[model samples]
Target: MTESPSVITKRADFLAANRGLRVARPGFVLLAQPNDGKGKRYGITVTKKIGNAVVRNRMKRRFRELLRAQLPVRGLPDHDHVLIGRDGGIERAFARLAEELDDALARAAAGKGDPRRRRPARGNRR
Candidate 1:
């Protein structure tokens, strides 16, 4: 797929729409929210905690491919989706990853009640 149709290129956009809905699976975590514009925009986030730069980049690549293949069909219109890669993402089979993404999207869209879905408390640790 072309870059313009499948990517969410701005940090501000990601954060502003961050409060929508989330779905977690063993392979990845998906955060999705309604967008103000048309089409589906996506972002992939692989944190340093997953691995070194090389490993992180590999996971991001996997996510990009998965999104490219699945998003157009499974994704909702005018929504921004951020795919957070988990350590297992790199190892999981592509088919399984796609299945997980399908399930996550469905659950997120259905607005399943997620008990652990609240923001953390803010306070001084010390």
Candidate 2:
């Protein structure tokens, strides 16, 4: 299922709740976090260090495409995730970022803290 833009969590909320999920390499850092809601939502954060507007926008576009292709298959839901692009992002190959995202999602799924842990209770707990 695709996440609609309307459901995307605002920046303020993301900062307050996302504890962060990090994967580091010599060239860059990938930080992801769980959003406190249903269906997976994503945002991108590229700083000046990454490059000027042209570079930043390109990075965001790459992250968006890779994430869209890499996520829904795993059934991630109601989570707000942010990918912070590091310096030299413009030069990072598209496939590399996609692979990193796939790996990161695998890591998230393996952990108990994965935002997918929450499913609306189907019945009365009592």
Candidate 3:
């Protein structure tokens, strides 16, 4: 299908949605927040911890493809979503990636608000 209608291009948008609901899966972490915008927008982030520049770019590409394929059918319109790639994201099969994305979106939409689903804060060790 054609590329998703809108993309989250501005840094402000990302910051604005930072406190939104989150869904974490083995492959990726999804942050979703409601927006007043017209259509769905998305962003992908792959941190250096995941790998070097090439690896990060590859992860972003995979996330982009997932968004393009799934957003139209399963994404929430008027919402902003950011997909953060994790260590296994690149190595995971595309089909499984898509499946996880679908499940994450569904959970986000349902607003289940599972406290256990959140990622634990990193603790400093002396």
**Candidate with maximal TM-score:** 3
Give each model's whole-structure lDDT: 0.80, 0.61, 0.85
Candidate 1 regions exceeding 4 Å error are 1-4, 116-120, 123-126
Top lDDT hit = 3
Candidate 3 ranges beyond 4 A from true positions: 1-3, 114-126
Q: For candidate 2, write residues 1-126 as lDDT tens digits.
A: 554432344767557434665555322454455655545666667788777788888877887777667666743565555666777666778777667667766665665333423556779544
Could you give candidate 1's per-residue lDDT for residues 1-126 as a string of tens digits?
533446888898778556778788888888888888757889988888898999899888888888887778777778898988887888899889989988987887687724546555677333
**1 against 2, candidate with superior TM-score:** 1
The count of backbone overlaps in candidate 3 is: 0
Cα error, candidate 3, residue 114 (Å): 4.3
Clashes of each: 0, 5, 0
Ranking under TM-score, best-scoring first? 3, 1, 2
Model 3 per-residue lDDT at 85: 86
Task: Give the clashing residue pairs of candidate 3, or none.
Answer: none
| TM-score per candidate | 0.84, 0.69, 0.86
* Candidate 3 lDDT tens digits, 1-126: 534748888888887767788889999988887878658889888889999999999889889989988888788878898998899888999999999999999998898544544466677433
Which portions of model 2 show Cα errors greater than 4 Å?
Answer: 1-9, 25-32, 112-126
